[model samples]
Target: MIQNEIIETIETIETICSRRSVRKYTADSVSDEAVLTMLECARFAPSGLNNQPWRFIVVDDREIGRRLSELTHYSDIVASAPLLIAVFLDTDASYNRDKDLMAIGASIQNILLSAHSLGLGAVWLGEILKNKESVSKILNAPGSFELTAVVAVGHLDESDPGTAERKALDEIVFKNKY
Candidate 1:
């Protein structure tokens, strides 16, 4: 049993390392089942007081997806991806702004990792905050739900070799003194 747990731990770490912001995607469509599975994984993300304030607007319709794409700077990428998930926060349900925002971030990370684990690609768009009001209206989200991010999801185009450069542990980490 311990050996299985170790293997699972390794797999989780590998998924985190392998994930990349895939900006390009194939023409193939992402199934509804897959999207539901990703959301299920996200539901388990930790939250302050177990508030779990995150809400999602899954846009699979072509016209709605196109309109949502227009709301973000990553228009081309969002327009082409087969799926778009509008992540929102229920302000009323949150304990506080900061903690809820942190929880939302964790939930989105879980969604991205879950997508990668299921052989789907996803990119988080925070720029939507610039036009949050417009986006909120477009998605018809309730007044209490504040738009936080727009995630474009689909099968990644393998032809594009996206880079995932990062600082080494020695460069970013510090001792207790530091």
Candidate 2:
């Protein structure tokens, strides 16, 4: 049991560390099974009071994806990726506003990590929030749903997108108090 646990832990760490924001992807489409697996992982993400306020609008239509791409600077990725998932906060299901938003963020992270584990590349497009209203309208989402993020996903074109540099732990972490 311990050996299995350690192996699982190692695999999880590898997946997290190796995951990168893939802006380029192949023309091939993502499988329905793969997309559903990602969403299943997202639904299990921790939520405040277990309200589970996160809602997703999966957009696979090329025309709709193009329209959405116009709202973000990451237009190339959005327009070209085989799949797009618009994460939304269902206001009616929220408990506390701030906590629910954090929960939604966790949900989005789950989607990204799961996509990576499934050998699919995904980029979370938050800059699209500047045109949140327009995005909502395009997706025909309910008024109660607030746009949180748009993730572009597909089979990666690049073999390795490469890792980004990060600040040392000591620079960001504090023992007790800052």
Candidate 3:
């Protein structure tokens, strides 16, 4: 019963599931159009009470990207990517901080899915997360929004990695009463 778009999205998820933390990329840039589309998808992710407390800041300027890379101690992986997304969680949302954080995490899923569907590659940049305040100032983000993480994206330099080793289903899945 899947719609064509839904089926395409499933295939996209599978492709992204094979994605690795790509550390290398050519200097080619990601188009503004692609970045726009990714943000559009992120805008639609579910949020608690529809609070939708996420603000996305896209950084594609090489100098800005380099400065952000420096401020957050991002590795070559981040520096090489043509696009960097500053995922902001609006703390002023109608929910508690935890809810805001949880909601932002869901929105990141949408970004990933959309990027994958578009044939671009992205790696979740976690180090940027540890330096939120500094990152905010560097990016000129509003004080009300908290920096959560950066998603570095670009055309990949390597092929998609195959299925990863995962825990057995029996080990993690539980029945209704478990």
Candidate-wise lDDT, in order: 0.89, 0.92, 0.78
For 1-178, candidate 1 gives per-residue lDDT tens digits of 9999999999999999999988899989998899999999888999999999999999888788788778778789889988988899998898888989999999999999999999988999898789999988988999999998988899989975556999877787887344
Clashing pairs in 1: none
Please, what is the TM-score per model? 0.95, 0.95, 0.84
RMSD of each: 1.7, 1.9, 3.0
Summing lDDT over every window of 10 consecutive residues in candidate 2, give the lowest-scoring window: 159-168
Instruction: Write down the worst ten-residue block by lDDT for model 1.
Output: 169-178
Worst 10 residues of 3 by lDDT: 156-165
What is the per-residue lDDT of model 2 for residues 1-178, given as tens digits with 9 covering 90 to 100? 9999999999999999889888888989999999999999999999988999999999999999999989988899899999999999999998899999999889989999999999999988899999999999999999999999999999988864745778877888989363
User: What order do you get sorting by lDDT, best first?
Assistant: 2, 1, 3
List residue ranges in candidate 2 displaced over 4 A: 159-163, 176-178
